[model samples]
Target chain A: MIFDDVTAVWNQFNLTERTIEHLWMFSIALTISVILGIILGIILYQHKKYAEPALNGLNALETFPDMALLVLLIPVAGIGEVPTIIACIIYSLLPVTRNTYTGLVSVRPEILEAGTAIGLTEADIVRNIRIPVSLPMIAGGIRIAIVFTMGIVTLGGIIGAGGLGAPLQTGIVLLLPDVIIVTGLWVGILAVIFDGCAGMIEKRLTVRYGEW
Target chain B: MTSIHPFETIDRIELSHLTKTYGDVTAVSDVSLDVIGGELLVLIGGSGSGKTTTLRMVNRLIEPDSGIVRINGTDIREFDEVRLRRNIGYVIQQIGLFSHMNVGDNIGLIPKIEGWGKEQIDARVHELLEMVDLPPEIFSARYPRELSGGQQQRVGLARALVMNPSLFLMDEPFGALDPILRKQLQEEFLTIKYDIGRTIIFVTHDIDEAFKLGDRICIMHEGELVQIGTPEELIFHPETDQVAHLVDANRKYRHIETFTVHDLMSPLSKREFYEANMPVSEAMAKILSDETGIAVVMEGNNLRGTTSRQNIVRNRKKNLLLGDITTEPITVTPEDALVPVLQKMKTKNASSALVINREGEVTGMLIPDSVLFHII
Candidate 1:
């Protein structure tokens, strides 16, 4: 059962190139999400008026269906990893951006007052106390985003982005249950592994900073 | 010692007509007071009474909407904010040692920022750790999480003192500590102050702490100074009902000068005399022992001193020559305050004091009971 005739189908499936493309798409999406999310988070934290609007926009983005977002991006960037990554990044940004803004703002007032009283410059306060203390929540947000994007990246393969999802889409149309189950299992395992690692990092940061 | 510089002599600090408003609420209003150099002046008030706001205005942490803060003869506004803050040491109740850095790095920050060489900064950090009773080798490499609350505070003090700034601004540095730890830190701060000789502006809501550490206390109410004076001046003569209530809790520690042996010491009289060669055994029997215990010992035309029961018990021998068995006792002059005398008693582990005169002779012996009587 471990290496049934389904193994033959999987072996000839070109899983290597598909997996690489999948990883490429996932990485591109993650990188873009992290960069854009952090910028948006910092802006939301620093700008008193921007938080509500930015959060509302993110909530609206979250409500949009993943397939619909991919469809929306296709017209702009065309089919393939580019549109796939863009759609996945938009899907992943909501949690990270919102969590980062909340975390930075919720730092204890006493801690900040102590920093100011000790003659720390405004920049020093941000660099030294505010950022470090808010790091656990920031990391948590990123973790959630990564796991959410990984699930979405597989669906991107439906549009010819080239991943395990391509075989998955083909298996579904061709009624090949073996390919569908194997690819789905592997992707699920990868998501769990990635999220577990991020959870560990968040735990360590919390223990160090006495905050989360 | 190098000759004192002109700047060293400039000790006075004055905040005149200070005011601060946050929207509709005024935090401080028209507050003014002069603090002498080398004095630990504590600002005591309840929460929202403007004590912290007033302290903040001195260092320009909170810009006063109006008024001037003068240090020596110059206004603080004349100095750049960064440069002014660099010249003053600040410690707070939370003990905010940077969690990211190890102890040595935190303590070395000021000297490093001041552009000292690596060797000098390291040496200064070592000196400050020892001064604050933390061994550098043990604590310098440890991060803030590894230390206890009290240890963190000690490191905080070391960090504040690292630059050897001329003035210290402490905002309830012991407020977060447990009672026993708070007492220990207060005692340690006193020793540090005596050694460093820095003018200190301290803020505390605790009346007992204000009395214990302050050379002069400034009582504030609703954004204004209620009264400012020495502890004795505040206790014996409070200027307002608010000050009296503020000090009422600390009246016992406040009047410690009255309980000193100096207060009980009687002036020398011609009634007592003895030859220099008097036998110790005979002298012990001749001196009357009462509830107060022991009598004064006069040699020739001068007063030698009193001998205590504890002294006799320690030097027990049959022959007991006065010169052999009797030791010259420690005494205080009439002008010495009871607090210092009590401090000496605690430090030297002594039971009583001898009052001495201008002629280097004992005027009278002062026992603990006599001091207690006067205090009660």
Candidate 2:
């Protein structure tokens, strides 16, 4: 029976393990993107001369098609999680870096002057005034990166990395409608749940920092 | 009240040949001045006059191109830039209170930077809030946007004074406020300064404010020093035609001269002698009621001279008595021309005139405005 095969397919596949794998790969990519993006943003801010070139380069990285980036990395990094995570990090860098830079640079001049005039050191000004005022924008960038990474991690399964995407690809190869439907549902659900968490984090941070 | 400055004797702030340039345009060109400690020296000029540049130079906000700023006779360049700024309070027209922080945090910022303990900073914030007439319990947690313009400025003043710095640099600090609020804050600032006694360099385009608040005003025009003198000196003896024009706006009231009451008082008429002790307003009311428009001002039994409605009006304060209004009748002998007496009255801010004979006998009377009308 069709129902019997569909049930057998569900029993045969390790859905939980693939979802966990998907989350781990996405988390690794997101964490690296966050750290690298913020550092690059700050570096770009400090040496403004480097900002133009660095930003143009980052824009190029973002403009690279997702699958092409994954394919390009496969030659050196090979298949599986290595190339998949590398692709995810590159795809996520633009929003986090650009937004962090925007947040820091866009702080009001009068506020910065007030900070300096009050005798705060450069470090103190960055920590006390610039960072706090720019946090909401930075958080928005983080949310975007996290959601984008979650969606892109689906491609990891094509490279033989274990994730919710593996079954969806298998179903397409075999032309099985039921397999596609169930696995596609899981992908959409996983993406929404992770994106919601990121959005919640953004909201919490923005509320804590207060509006500028 | 604490000893905020390390220097024992901070007597003067001297700017020597101070100059600044922005690209091709000169913002301040070789301006020099000395301000005594506790003195509020007003720098007055139109836009592009370099008044603000000159003030900012003292705090190194705008570093001068070629000259030096010496605070307490020591070159400010010798002091560490951060430490120097920490010891100098600054307030600008924008009243840049940090929007992120509440009132208490804003006021406590300098102390925090100076490494004051949390308790000490909190206590000081409360104290400054009270000094600025904003109670801590109500204002401490409130952000700057919650405050009105005047209130935000008071917070700015509190923030500046919280450091209790050796000097204050105010660049049109009250320029953002409307006239009435500006006047009120100016008075409040004077009272605050009286307590703090911090040497302040105040910059403004307002000549009247310069006259009111400055112990000495330095006028700037096109990045050059036009003149520097006491308000009275500037008014009476303008060094340049430009200054004369700058001050001409208030020329009508700038005249100052020594004139006795007798010079402007009229002679006794049929009106009963009003004692010097009578309230000026009452005397004015009486003079206005009387058809003769004059009251004989008496010192005990001796009739001094007459006062006109104009004199009473000019000298009248809310509770000022006739005695306070009565000056010795500065009698102009009958030989004297009306023009000279009127000129003296104008200078003296007097309105009435006493026409007396050579022996100083009370004769006919003259009110300056009325007498000038007849004689002209």
Candidate 3:
């Protein structure tokens, strides 16, 4: 009967509207954070002076607990997917931004000079040479950000965001070990899936860019 | 056979007292030279001698601190920066081919930048790929990463020439190549120069390369122009001991024609001549054999001048075997070195010499007067 209950909870977990909503919230946060993180990374790469100050500020922000950012966002965004997404984007910005800046700047000066001498305009150089050459490093940063965001997103449930985190929080409050184990397993599986996807994409980008 | 006016000659590059300084260090010091239309000017010197700086100044890649650089009498500074760069082709030691771009796009860059139409750019790319000895179909789609160093250099040259610029500035373009590839590229560059007829300001530290390729060689030393002249002029009359040492290193290769064979040949033109088993009387009928007091020699179809009328007169010993009284004159082929010829003449006490073909046939006589002509 215990095994039946556990199986029933497992089947119901994926079907529940709140669980589905939580998954949707996690997906939205991940997607938005990745996009915003990449944009910020590119910005930091283009402006060296801004990179130091901005990265330092973000480093300071990262030192704060993830729950602190989640709680801080609730007053403004009112406990929904918006607050969760904003929090994830902010948290993910550091790795992606730092990595992109480092990668772009690390390109050999001769390679950039070759591009310029071959008559590539500044914009074309950035788009074609600098960005493509640095894409491997950028992808690495995004991979790190994805894993970090995945781990942190579960905390979003504390602020009324949905997904496996909500059920886990409830299971812990109600002392339901079966519910906790099921929800924890789902979160673990989701993190592994997110990590695997990021790793594959990073590898593909590295191969495409001719980076070893 | 067209007349090239000094003023109207296209591809003529003139640097008028050009100077460049980086802080306290003078990179190029008041160097002036003219590379006439269609001439290859080689700038050669050791490291930090300003040969490269001087070459770059012509293209305004390194703007001179002072002085005018003109192309066909028009100041280069007068043109817009992009326009000026487009008109002067530049190739550096590091080939600098864009790694991210395909070979065709890299080669087509200048034309595309100039707003050439799609058809024009495509045709230009293919034309240049073939011009550089690379087939377009095979190489066009490949990236720079797929090419060898030599192939990359060829593509770099094609990129430089995409706009068909009249002046080419090459800064140690072959410096990084292996010796064999360097020689090959040098030969190919010479052929390209002959075909294109652009004014080339080629920089190198190699004296052999300078002599092999330059129509005019400009030697630089310590940021100053030491000497500028043709290879012969520089070899014979180097301006300083430094220039002399540079020329002296190449002296062994300078041909004998640079000095006259006459300087060491015998002055006598009289000798006895013999016809195939003929009587002396008939042999005397030939003007070259007529003089009794001379020793005539056979050279191919005609009898050459005798050694001396006096020697034949004194020996009047008859049956006068042709070999008996005939003095074997010192001779040299046209390709022999002047130093060796001089040493042979001094050892032989010869007043005149015979210019002979490979088959030992005399083509001409080198008299003492001919030797004086070169010196005077």
Off by over 4 Å in 2: A1-13, A193-212, B1-9, B249-376
The true-structure Cα RMSD of candidate 1 reads: 13.1
lDDT of 1: 0.75
Q: Comparing 2 and 3 by TM-score, which wins?
A: 2
TM-score attained by model 1 = 0.76
The TM-score ranking, best first, is 1, 2, 3
> Model 1, which residues run further than 4 Å from truth?
A4-6, B1-10, B22-25, B109-122, B249-376
Better of 1 and 3 by DockQ: 1
TM-score of each: 0.76, 0.75, 0.71
Best-fitting candidate, scored by DockQ:
2
Better of 1 and 2 by DockQ: 2
Best-fitting candidate, measured by lDDT?
Answer: 2
- lDDT: worst 10-residue window of model 3 chain A: A112-121
List model 2 lDDT by residue over B49-80, tens digit each: 99988887877777889999887778887777
Residue B265 CA error for candidate 2 (Å)? Answer: 29
Superposed on all Cα atoms, the candidates' RMSDs to the truth, in angstroms, are: 13.1, 13.6, 18.0
| A1-212 per-residue lDDT for model 2 (tens digits) | 96786566676676777778888888899999999989888888888888878888988888888878777788899999888888888878888888888888888888888778767779888888888887778889988898778877887777787787787778888898888887787788777887788788778766656554
DockQ values, each candidate: 0.19, 0.32, 0.15
Instruction: Give the TM-score comparing model 3 with the true structure, all chains together.
Output: 0.71
